[model samples]
Target: MSEDRISRDTEVLVVGLGRFGSALAATLERLGREVLAVETDEYLVQQWSHRLPVIEADATNPEALEQLGAEDFQVAVVGVGTSLEASVLITANLVDLEVPQIWAKAVSAEHGRILRRIGAHHVVYPEYDAGARVAHMVSGRMLDYIEMEDGFTIVKMRPPRETHGFTLGESKIREKYGVAVIGVKPPGEPFEYATDSTHIGADDLLIVSGDTNLLEAFAHRP
Candidate 1:
């Protein structure tokens, strides 16, 4: 979907009150947006009734969705992750309703492709992405990172003991390590961007950007 497809005035419809759906609804409400959430189960509906406009209806049922004014929503998110069949059917119904944008969650790459083919505007593999992130966090000293693209990344890493007490300019990290230090968080002070005079200290968290493998190696450095 385009960045500006949904504006402040646009209403959002979230189907399925699973963890992902409930969290999405809460966040949208927190952002001060009007949200309509639908779930087939009465218990799930009650759980989020106070959070947003909750409707107990089967989203895969086109008639049910229509009764809730689904077509009036600017965007719809299908968060049914357990059943691919249900996800696809709901996606088809949303398309039939002519919702401007529909985002659906899929369990695998194949499911994602199928959802796209069935008219979902965007398909997200949340499980796959979360698994990769968890693996990275458990591997070594790597704290966290954002996958910017295929070959590049931005990561947070704990400073190595070898660089202790060295000022950023004196160490010449960019010249030698081939990774640019974007910012650093000291023991207690707020994070400071990498400047000529910035000094490296123990327990400092460094934010660096560079090649993916190179950044991983830096993260694992002793």
Candidate 2:
């Protein structure tokens, strides 16, 4: 979805209140958006009912979704990844309702592809993202990591001690390490993408992306 797509509506229908769905609903509500959550788990529905409108029903059932005015929602999220069949069916139901945008959580790459084929506008692998982040934290330099397709990654990290006195042009990071320095956020300064003249600072956080092997090489010291 385009960046502007988020402006479509603040009302979001979150189907299946798993960990991801529940957290997403809560966050959206905190942002002052209207959240309507659906779940088959009666206990969770009861637990969250006071916080938002929780409908206790099967989200895969088109009848229940339609009754809740699913079509009126600009965004719908399907987070039932445990059961592949159920996740696909629920996504299809949301599509049939013509929700403008749908975000679905998937357990694997195959699941993600299926979700897209069935009409989910975006599919995410939360477990994979979390795992990559944790791995980067335990490693060196990497403050954050985003895994991209084909074993590529975008890494945000503090400039190494060796970079304190060098300008980005002088650093020759792209030439020396084969990883692109996409952006930089200096201490007490706004973040900006790279240009030859941008001076590197001791406290700056550099954003870079490239092959996983190259990123690991650039960050590895021992």
Candidate 3:
């Protein structure tokens, strides 16, 4: 709904008209993007038909996707998270079609593993991201968290008061918190990932990566 949302008519194929997929399609449509919503459930297809161009077809079928002109689309989003079988199949089909950008919604680590193996360009866990953001808000440490793998995460946070004037090596975060300061974004400056000797400042945003437990522990430390 924001006026800043770009209105480009880029072609995007959407598989599975579930809650996530439907929401994605509607948002993209509002942004003036061409969305082709595909669903295996006839009931869901009918429900969203009024607001979207619905196709009641199984995305597991490679031929169905081909007929739907999925390969022609610049991007594809597979949002069947409930059923791992369906999600994996649809992701594989998209890969086979050579979709340039394939983003799949994964419910679990195992599900993400299979999706990536089959060639999902990006795997997202909506629930996990929301939970992490909420957790950070309560602790007042991280601005955001991005999961890189099952156990590892990247955390964005302002430099702690204790680390206000210390250089990266002086802080000894790798030894104390078991995290690596990968990048720093100072106020009004572009992010720098190669800053090892740069001193931490009150306004500098630190990007660090470590296990979730380690990151959370560091975030809550006094």
- Kindly report which residue pairs in candidate 1 clash with one another: none
Minimum summed lDDT over a 10-residue window in model 3 is located at 1-10
Candidate 2, residues 1-222, lDDT tens digits: the string is: 454766744688999888999999998888888899999998999999988899999987899888988988888889799999999999999999888889999999999999999899999999988986888867888888887789889988777666676877888888888888898898888999888777788778899899988998787743
lDDT of 3 by residue, 93-151 (tens): 88888877889999988889999999998899877878877777578678887777688
Winning candidate number (TM-score): 1
**What local lDDT score does residue 90 receive in model 3, on the 0 to 100 scale?**
92
Q: Could you tell me every candidate's TM-score relative to the true structure? A: 0.91, 0.79, 0.62
Report how far residue 195 has shifted in candidate 2, in Å. Answer: 5.7
lDDT of 3: 0.84
Per-residue lDDT, model 2, residue 136, is: 82
User: Which residue pairs collide in model 2, if any?
Assistant: none
